[model samples]
Target: MSTAVTAGASGAPRRVPATVHRRRWAILGVLIFALLVVVLDNSILNVAMKTIASPAPIGLGASQSDLEWAINSYTLVFAGLLFTSGLLGDRLGRKKVLLAGMVVFGGGSLLSAVAGSPGQLITFRAVMGLGGALVMPATLAIIMNVFERDEQPKAIGVWAGAVGLAIAIGPITGGLLLQHFWWGSVFLVNLPIVLVALVGMVLLIPDSRDPNPGRLDPVGVLLSVIGLVLLIYGIIKGGQLADFTDPAAWGTVAGGLAVLAAFVLYERRAEHPALDVTWFRNPRFSASVAVIGLVFFALMGVTFFGAFYLQSVRGYSALKAGALLLPLAVAQMAFAPRARLVVDRYGVRATCAGGMALVALAFLGYLTLDTTTPIWVLEVIGFVMGTGMAHVMPPVTVTIMSALPREKAGSGSAINNTFRQVGGSLGVAVLGAMLSAAYRNGMSDHLSAVPPALRGPAGESIEATLGVARQLGPRGAALVDPAKESFVHAMHIVAGTSAGVILLGAVVALVLFPGRLPVPDAVGAQPEAEPEAAPAETA
Candidate 1:
């Protein structure tokens, strides 16, 4: 049962126990179990929002603004601290940080479940966000330490699959929990996952850190957290208002950008920088992160609208809509692990670009969607999109992690995640605004049926119009068809626009990603006793 492990993170190969290598996949599984709660929490909340907003005994009677803050607070806090948390993981130990994060997150989840007021829930959610920030980077960083270079992609694919699993089941899980229990049950669900993850981390994962971490860059860390908080908050606000020109949104965004610029400057001069800003100079690294941002931008924006399409336009319940998304998740689960094979055969550029092209095809399918489109067709389109993303994420992640030395995996993971979050934020803000404008334009004349007092709000969204219509009794019937039609039209317009962006990403991949992954020289002479030496045919 004894085996030698070559820890990937040290500047030198740190010889360790063979069990670290033998149970590497199990360690990854535990990490993914931990990640499942965090990643899916955002989407799972979508189903439970109305319940959370209900009056007491059922919910805390949260207002629209409170609800917005409840969500934004978590996202802003989580994004803001990612860089710092990653740095901490490097300076301290990945496993230690990971364990601490799980404890905090679990505590926050318990607090959130029992909250007496929306204010408490929001505050507790921020605590959860902080914990999530600490947890996310450490998982990937640990993966970098545990898996050898050739096997990283396969391990990462399994990691990515957990995200798809969360996506596939989050809404259904939330909806079911809400149906049988109090609104708090949605949050309480994290407990089991956290508990299992904690146990696994304790038993399976070994801590690893940067052997030569330099002096702490407190200034760089401060600047990064401050900038990301402001930037992400601004993006949320812009999406809410559906306009970036508003001083409240644009001003904060500009400030965030400026502070980030300053952080980069400070890091360049710092003897011990939190991150190597020069990584951006490498076209391979830069392009990989860029594609991550672009792909998520398209994915998140479209998915945001997709929920509305299912709920409001097609009149599906949250549970049913969530179930419809299952095919997408399944496709990612099936294909993400296999994407490396495609990359190995065709090279990074071809595989990535081809994936993006497939995503474009999915968007084109989106363009064909109608209020009356069959459920199976929606599932098929979703599967296609998921398949495309399965290919896109793993190779790009490999490229980014490969470019950085293993010891910097935490920072590298942070960079990858930061770009993804920001890109998704930009997508939701920009594409949401476009959808609003198009819907408003399509509803212009049809809105005459709405009461003068309700007309402005009715044009805002299908849900709003339907709310107004419900009050009008028999006369309100006139608004339903137009609202649905206008929304469908807007979805098509956005779908076409999203397709264009995905195609652009394909071009970026072709031009910038490394031409092909060179066959690792160790492929042929790998010793059987050494666990890290061989390609994992299956993770």
Candidate 2:
């Protein structure tokens, strides 16, 4: 029941085959399955951060910045290649690109599983990100092609739900694997899922592509990759030293910004720009993307500190830490699919603003968390955060997707995800830096009792401090309470920063997102609104 698509430049549109139409739901299922693996790999890594930082036999002995790079490397590559991958999928045939992405992703996962050091893991994670860049846009683009406008909201809602669910549950899966197997098991776990996704892709999915695709713009792609890498590297380095005064810190960031600025100029002048910068001219499109970026910025930053808080400070096993994330997952799974109903009733501006408010409230809850804060309180925060996010993603995604023509679905999805990954990557780097600076400041006086030679390393993170304390025997035992207190204080600063960012997103949503009528017609929710989601031609 493969899909029969129109010719690349056909004048006549092809009717979707009845059989293919019937299997559209199944196709969506496989697409989400593929989506899960990409998300799971990262989410799983979050819980394993503590274990990964442990010495030699127990873990990779990675530093906090090493862990940050490990996460950012994947995100950078994913964000950098997303637009190009979207273009490639639109040009070279989506199913082919999807299959290739799966194979590459599987290989990356295997390599990461055998990674002997943080450097190797970081490199392999980038490889996985490449595959992800191909997989993500294709999934959404294909959904746009197969489903009718009326059905798109529902299908995309489920897709978005799966994304949140995968992110939420990834830690639990990682915890289970870490408890019984090894830290590498987190990466290894992806292999089987990739295998299943590959089989499904081969069996159910169909090939389709844009009739008139834009130029590949290899130069733009290269610039984006280099600029983002340089930027993230500088941020992580600044965090590592706990200072931006060093020339290496400010200089690199300056170079990255200059490169990015050059990339933008080149794009504006290019005959066929990789990213159509004009897309941002549409208030709805730009607003939605900005909100997405800010939300991710807050979420990713907070979650980075969350792993340490759950395991390093609370003394929870990886399994227990994973379990504690369940309320967030439950909230996402329960509300994501139904979020559209709220949008249909209350409109985009009000709904998203409301959701952002919930997210802000949740971040504030983190400030109250301490060495012995009740686990249920964290659960409540997770649920609130997840519920808010569920409402936000679907509406914004629908707007982004609907703004573009059906043939350009790949590019549309790329724009949506690019901001998302960029925001997340930056959030981790920036917040990770803040966390480091605050923790080091708090730990400085406390660390004088420790041997001078080890103080630098001990103040790097709670994991480092705890590991050092263990190595020091009785003398190190005295450092435990101080380390926990310092970490909690650092976490508080990050939590507050995250809350501020979320509020900014709320303001953006409230100000820039257009209002709509109470009821959406068969055509769209708000035809008169900015960046209307018009009914696209069926291929």
Best by the lDDT measure: 1
Which 10 residues in a row give candidate 2 its minimum summed lDDT? 526-535
Compared with the true structure, what per-residue lDDT tens digits does model 2 show for residues 161-274? Answer: 898788768878887888798888998988889898889888887677776656678898788768866776676566556677777877888888898899899999999887
Quote the lDDT for 317 in model 1.
89
* RMSD in angstroms between candidate 2 and the native structure over all alpha carbons: 5.3
Deviation from native of the Cα of residue 204 in model 2, angstroms = 1.7
> Cα lDDT of all candidates, in order?
0.85, 0.82
lDDT of 1 by residue, 332-368 (tens): 9999999999988899999999999989999999877
lDDT of 1: 0.85
Q: Per-residue lDDT for 385 in model 2?
A: 91
TM-score of each: 0.94, 0.88
